[model samples]
Target: MNLKARITRTGAILLGKYVACDGFDEQQPIRVVTHVHADHMLGLRESLKKCEMVLMSEATRDLIDVLKSPLFLMAGNVKTLPYKEPFEYKNEKITFYPADHILGSTQVLVEDQEGERILYTSDFRLPNTPIIRSDILVIEATYGSPRCIRNFEQKAESVLVDLVDRGLCEGPVYLFGYHGKIQEVMEILWKNNIRVPFIVPEKVFHVCKVYEKHNKKLGRYWLARSEYAKELRSKKEPFVAFYHMAARRRFIKEKAYKIFVSGWQFQEPIRQVNEKGFVIAISDHSDFEGLIEYVRKSKPKLVLTDNYRIGHAKILAKEIEKRLGIRAIAVPPTKPKKK
Candidate 1:
């Protein structure tokens, strides 16, 4: 397939015909933001100024309203589209499919007037992630390396529950991860029937509300500063407190047990960081095998491995070509831009 495929230095995938996904290009009249990740918001301001319309899933738009200022979405040209429902623009069709990444993440499909299809998969995971067929595939390689496999992925949730259960027996338990990740842990604990109340900062508490509003029901949680939470903190009753990944340093391990969430673990899912602390492997992204499986199942004639910002896109593309016999190449990161 000689389809137009390339990523701007700022990590935006450009179809060059109708739209730009995950990044901005002044040349395209349409801009599609796949998720709320900071990297994907590159050139957003410019796109909003230049494009006719900027689009995202409704959940993604709400996430921005919560995590970011809502002023961005109040723009006239910004719009939301339903999943599986296509919106026709000029001579193309665009649609968003739910992604198994964060709360509102999605993969985008663009089909031009010629009936040629292009898919840009923002970060996603497999076994559950939907596979969309297209002539050209643009995929994320956050775990694209051959070594980036999660053998304990299926058991990660169990391990997390066990660790937290054990930690509560001693004292307060502290957990750290990104915004969406923290919310995900809430679901895992709730589904397992762990009813222990969660105490998080005010921001995370708001994030949890958004999750609940979207029908992503999480368990009982309280704001860290609330009178109830403060009383609970003083009592011997053990509870979990969540923090953003950057707060790892602010954590005082001598006071309580800590479980750091990460997906980079290749050998052991649980790694001992200190006597009272450990790192557990749990990621929202598809592993190396999952990435290959996606391409194989989708059967795209050409694969564009996105390495513009992170992941071993070059290695992943090479692996795809060798293992699946599919033509794949990494999009070079050029003229990198800040979020």
Candidate 2:
């Protein structure tokens, strides 16, 4: 069996005859959307014009709906697939497994007629249950450097609790994070009995509702503009608010105690310290150690790394070859299209 594939730099997209991962193009009729992240959904709306169907997990489909994406408006364009279940697509056996990146993120496993296997992990993190193994492993290297390794989960809740405690005495605690992270933090707070009413942006609230609908039960959270927020603000008492990082500026006037959560907090310098917020190291992707451990567990014959950071994939590939003795290489970005 001859299998040829091309993956983009960030591993946001993969191209092949039977399986197209996370991204879409006119050439590939069957596109697999791994999750609802903006980068992963590239060309989806345009691809629907020509493609037969777009494959994604049900949770992701619901997320697109909550996001009010145009893709949701396209009738019969999206098809939902169950996770960890194998199905035939274009004569190849394909399976989807929980990626543990976000609520509905998944890793694709493909088996050809000859039993040759290929796995594409679009964006993943640790603490995930193992699914199928593969011969050729194409993995994301978002936090792929030795310097990116950090054991934050054990202390993440404590750190946030401490910050919340301190901020309660000062002012409203503003936490800046993405959709999944925000939900996870809220769950953590709830589990710890923090019980503080959380004010969340509209999008974040939508995601929380989806989580609850899926039986995850993120507890209670008020939408940003709801009466709950007005009541909390009018009390002149300290409160907690969760906002997307892009909306950080909206809370500046409130004089809230701000904290930005991300894995790159250590690597990238915080800009405009007086205005921007403090950094809290947190990540959804596997670190250097976790990536190495994943490679060891998968025990793939070939390892391919793709990430947004230049040289990250190459560096990780080198480390894999040195330590694991696997044939590893970094996938270069695809050439730019002509005008």
Clashes (backbone N, CA, C under 3 Å), per candidate, total 1, 0
Q: Which candidate ranks first by lDDT, i.e. highest?
A: 1
lDDT of 1 by residue, 142-174 (tens): 999989988888898999999999999997889
Error of 2 at 141 (Å): 0.7
Supply the global lDDT for candidate 2. 0.74
lDDT of 2 by residue, 1-339 (tens): 113455654333453356677665556667888887777877666666667777889888888888865456375577889987887877677788888888889888888776767888777777674644778888877767777767555676677777667777876788888888888877877777766788887888888888888778566778879987888888866667888888877777767678887767544423235643577776778778888888888888887887443327777888899999998877754323422
In order, candidate lDDTs are 0.86, 0.74
